[model samples]
Target: MPFTPFHMGAGLAAKALAGRHFSVLTFGIAQLAMDIEPLVGMLRDAPVLHGPTHTYLGAVPIACVTAALAPWLCRPLLRRWNQEVRHYRMPWLQESERWSPQVVLASALAGTFSHVLLDSVMHLDIRPWAPWSDTNGLYATISLSALHLLCMAGMAGGALGWVALQWLRSRRAAQRQRHNP
Candidate 1:
């Protein structure tokens, strides 16, 4: 999709928040969240599971458990980021208000699940249905060359189509609400 990084992140984060507030967004949120992890692949640089954990088998447990634990991860993981180059800083909230566990978890879980699913569609090597078997249940082959460009192309096309459909539906819904109201 042509969505900016912020929009994508916000979309998936919203999905995480949706678990506690299920409505029209449940599916969209899931899609957004699943899409997030695949895009942000800092791990891709490392010699990790076929380009930053794109394996379907790897994404599922991560999705479900992460979704289940989303509430926990979102509640201000107060830790110190002590870089040798920079001064040590602790991550804390600006306000004194405490976060709700359920809400926090919901945000994280949705984002995680969405990330896994989207990654699977994006990469054929990702075995979304793995752990059940030794082989990766990837939808696409992992040749990592121009020969397999079609695989990624298809995934990108699907995402674009999905985004277009969603935008159209939202526009129609807004029109309906505006006219009817």
Candidate 2:
């Protein structure tokens, strides 16, 4: 799942559910950070692609570091994203670049943990409980197609839900304005 957009489905779903409590940008950064080890391994031709960083033990530190740094990294990127949204007249896609420390930390944790969980199911080499165990009990727990489908479903459902919420908010605001005017 290295460099794959599949992980974003979960992030989007989380954003839809948690609203202001979840930062999808932070979550995306954490996901990228989690896959760095595997990307390096692939580049170096190492035997173990999914190494320590793909474990629960490994994810904590990565999540913490990502959370600590995400605010700085995300601000400019989010500003650019919002700019594009405004230029495209997609107000519904606009989002606050600023995130609370709590939201950053939670999003980072969620991203790293979910990355590990999703990869564990698809890759045979991922020892998710590593240091304490080398077993991949989650490997192939479900079919590959099913996993992909689930991720896609999450992406679709989340996008629709977010748009629907935005539409409802706008409608209510319009109704209030009409009544007041």
Candidate 3:
């Protein structure tokens, strides 16, 4: 429903899985899921009684399936990154061995489920079990929902922008160093 929840759910999910992916899997997949049209279609319509996403038919299966597949989806790149994780001393990441497939899968499932559950609660119209009925919307928390999305969008977008700026700065610095050195 809201971008904040989506970001949080995805991020938390990735963290819970723990591995080379850190940000990529935890945040990336969650965001990717939201971006995907079929999953998004469930959100756009808001069928009834919480719609398809609310239903076990949809949410549970999704979580389960993703958990099963996250590794195959991420393995090679993850292996490469795991080899290099040592170079990064990010505050949030503690140095650890590459995560086991089982751990990553569990975390991915948790992340997907968390997103659906959180969204269902936030959007009153979220009929997670759609096709069964059309109970419409849950009316949302109004200003809170708006604020949540606004803040999340600003934060996520800001983070990406910040990274881009840093990259540019680094590039220029490198060029200057090359010319002066």
Question: Each candidate's root-mean-square deviation in Å?
Answer: 12.2, 1.8, 9.5
Candidate 3 C-alpha lDDT tens digits along 56-174: 34655655666666666666666655566535743222223355666665555555555555555555655544667555343354555674665466457655654555456557878
Candidate 2: residue pairs that collide: none
Q: Model 2, range 1-181, lDDT digits (tens) per residue?
A: 3789888889989988887789888999999999899889989998889988999999999999999999999999989988998898877667788888999999999999999999999999899998999999989999999998899988888888877876677678889999999
Give the winner by TM-score.
2
Q: What are the per-residue Cα lDDT tens digits for candidate 1 across 65-181?
A: 545544343333322211311242321111112345454445444444544444444444455454554344433434434323543454455445544554565578789999999
Better of 1 and 3 by TM-score: 3
For model 1, the superposed segments whose C-alpha errors exceed 4 Å read 1-97, 133-181
Off by over 4 Å in 2: 177-181
Residue 44 lDDT, candidate 2, scale 0-100? 93
Query: Which ten contiguous residues of candidate 1 have the minimum total lDDT?
Result: 88-97
Q: Model 3: which ten-residue window has the lowest total lDDT?
A: 89-98
Could you tell me how far off, in angstroms, the CA of residue 41 lies in candidate 2 after the best superposition?
0.8
The CA lDDT of each predicted structure is: 0.41, 0.90, 0.51
Number of clashing residue pairs in every model? 18, 0, 21
What lDDT score goes with residue 1 in model 3? 30
